[model samples]
Target: MITVPQLDQYKDLIGEDQLSQIYDKVRALSGLHVMHFNTTERGGGVAEILQSLLPLLEDLGIKHTWKVVPLDDTSNHFTAHLVDMLQGNIPGQLEAEDQQAFLDTLAQTPILSRPQDSQADLYFVHDFQLAPLTTLFPWLRPAIWFCHIDTANPNQYAKEYILRFLNNYNVCAFNSQASVFKELPREHVQVITLGIDPFKNKNKYITREQGMQAIARCGVDPTRPLITQVSRFGRWKNPWQVVDIYRLVKQHIPNVQVALVGAMEAADDIEANDVLADLRKYAKGDPDIHLLHDPTMIRDQEVNAFQRYSSVILQRSSREGFGLTATEAMWKEQPVIGTSSTGLRSQIIHEQTGYIVDDTQTSADYTLKLLQDRDLWRKLGQQAHEHVRKNFLFPMIVLGYLDALTKAMAFAHAQPNLSGGQKR
Candidate 1:
């Protein structure tokens, strides 16, 4: 586990005083044993946070353990389809036979059915995958569902299918109120923003020469103004509009270049490939328009290097749970232009930290203006970095979780019947 002093590497990012506050709060939660359960161990934000957070929890003397249960191999395809359905790509009822088939597959795994059987004091269930545990393990102690997706206005068809599992959770942790709280029942809702590690693989420092080398490897010229967006190419990420905005910006500054770099999350390959095809059509053989499928895995330090060198970062997502890429770019001291939807609205402080746009034309205009004006760009980037350091760093998130856990403990005790079959 990383020590308190080692975490001091981010002192500039997370002030020393703030770290002390987090440390003090977490130390108070040392009595409870926490188990964090999620679907994927390596692909998305949930897993990434668990990877960094668990160690920090341990360091703070919190008896926390992180675990992941693999979806049944035979049902991987159905799980993929289910993911798409929940994301608003598909809408319909799961036929009686199909529903049984899914349950049967779920039954093959014992993780959900045995949370109560474990020794932990609290269970933190992440996302919809393990949501059924509340029914299967009625004895599980005071479980909380940490939802990462936007559920503010769920698709009626999708909501009907998922509500059975959602209502079983004791409480829901959403990235933002606008993305989740409005339509959800007020009885069980908690708004907790996501955070990033300022000193991680994504937001580390890189020299100008190193950044240029990474851009050259991608075959993109570093001399020109660069507008880059890094995401999973998921449907809601709006990659096509990113390309359109770049084209509009190009009309104004012909020397401008755009780099759309992202990797494929589990079962998202088909959609990513489709988005890639659309991006290529816009590229039209232009070398300046680059699409990287898995650039970082192939070239270590490539993304860190790219953000450090880029003139401006673009996160024009249509529905963002939270824009970590924008926060990461801002941490690298690059001006970001993001949409005013969901978590993007919370991350960008209008013109103070970065620009917030409603459409491609507005995004393009702001991108051009920020890129051309070096002074404004630097100031925005500096302020943006400070914003992330103060609000979205790992330490801050750990503090929020500790506060939630403390409150949850008290809430659990007050319920008197949360101990499964044995009323206090």
Candidate 2:
């Protein structure tokens, strides 16, 4: 394990008082080994959060090993199609071949289904896609699955499928309590809010001229009102719908610019490409609207600059796994307009920090409102920045996971019957 004086870097952002609290919390788990498993190391928010979190775990004296399950083209496609259904698309039932492919992926990925060799003290699995791994390696450790996807409105097929292995985990954690509480058993479910690193590349200090230069490099008109939605090209990101909302807003502000910015992340990641093609077809040759997939433009510094330069940030996800990008923009002092779906509803404080809008019409209205009233936008942006500083930084998320793990350890004692049980 690699250790560094990492906590001190965050003291400037979160303050020494809170940093000391986090150090104390982590110290409780000082010598424990932690293993984390997820579907991919990129493209998804779980991977992104873990990338930021693992080093901090090591710095805090936790022996941590992060693993990514290899999903071949077949199971990979199944994963993408499932997210489509979660985004409200129609999905065909999973065939026996699909199940076999999933099993093959788990069986083949040695690092993922580990201790078939050596076990860790705490096993952390992320989301439904990897839930089946627990059934394969049942005797791992005191396991808790961190669900980053929305469970409140899970796809019927996925909900039924995931329930098969829910018992395999000692405890389950969700992004928010409001939506997912009813979906899960009350005894074992935990609410650990997602957070971002304000000291990240995008969150670092930059000037207005630097931000404008970065936006202009992406072919955006810096003078025009710019509306940005920065996330994966996932269908749930509501990427195309954002274009529709942009066109509607354009009817009101003729010279306003719209930028749908994201990057393709997996070998079998075709959904982003499919959506981008549709967006290109819809945009056709309209110069005011930019459908960008340039790898150079998606870098953290570039994304940071775009958020800094945006007139308004759009987080119109239909079902969000907590709007980390929206929170990042809020940290950049940019006003966010998010939908009232799962995670986003909890992030935006509705006109205090930013606005909570439902449909594309409402999103457009708010975009126009921000474009029209500079003072309100500025005020909301300021409040949004402060809100993130108080609640959504890196240390807060690490502390949340540690707190939940401590509670999960207690829950296992109360429900000893469920620990590694094959049947719920």
For 126-188, candidate 1 gives per-residue lDDT tens digits of 876666766666665577777677555555665666666655555667777775634446645
Locate the minimum summed-lDDT window of 10 residues in model 1: 415-424
Candidate 1 residue pairs that clash = none
- How much is the lDDT of residue 335 in candidate 1? 73
Give candidate 1's error at residue 97 in angstroms. Answer: 4.6
Q: Residue 53: error of model 2 in Å?
A: 0.7
lDDT of 2 by residue, 1-424 (tens): 2335676777676788877777777766788888888877876678789888888888778888887776777777887666655545355666778777777777767664445555787788887678777677766556788777766765677667777777767778888885453556776777787788876787887898988888888878888888899987777788877888888998988998889877667544667777888778888788988877767557777788888878889987888868788988999888898888788888889989888887788888888998999999999999999999888888778877888777656655555314434332
- Name model 1 segments beyond 4 Å from true: 1-3, 6-13, 72-99, 110-118, 182-188, 265-270, 295-300, 416-424
Estimated TM-score per prediction?
0.87, 0.91
Worst lDDT window (10 residues) for model 2? 415-424
RMSD to the true structure for each prediction, in A, is 3.4, 3.0
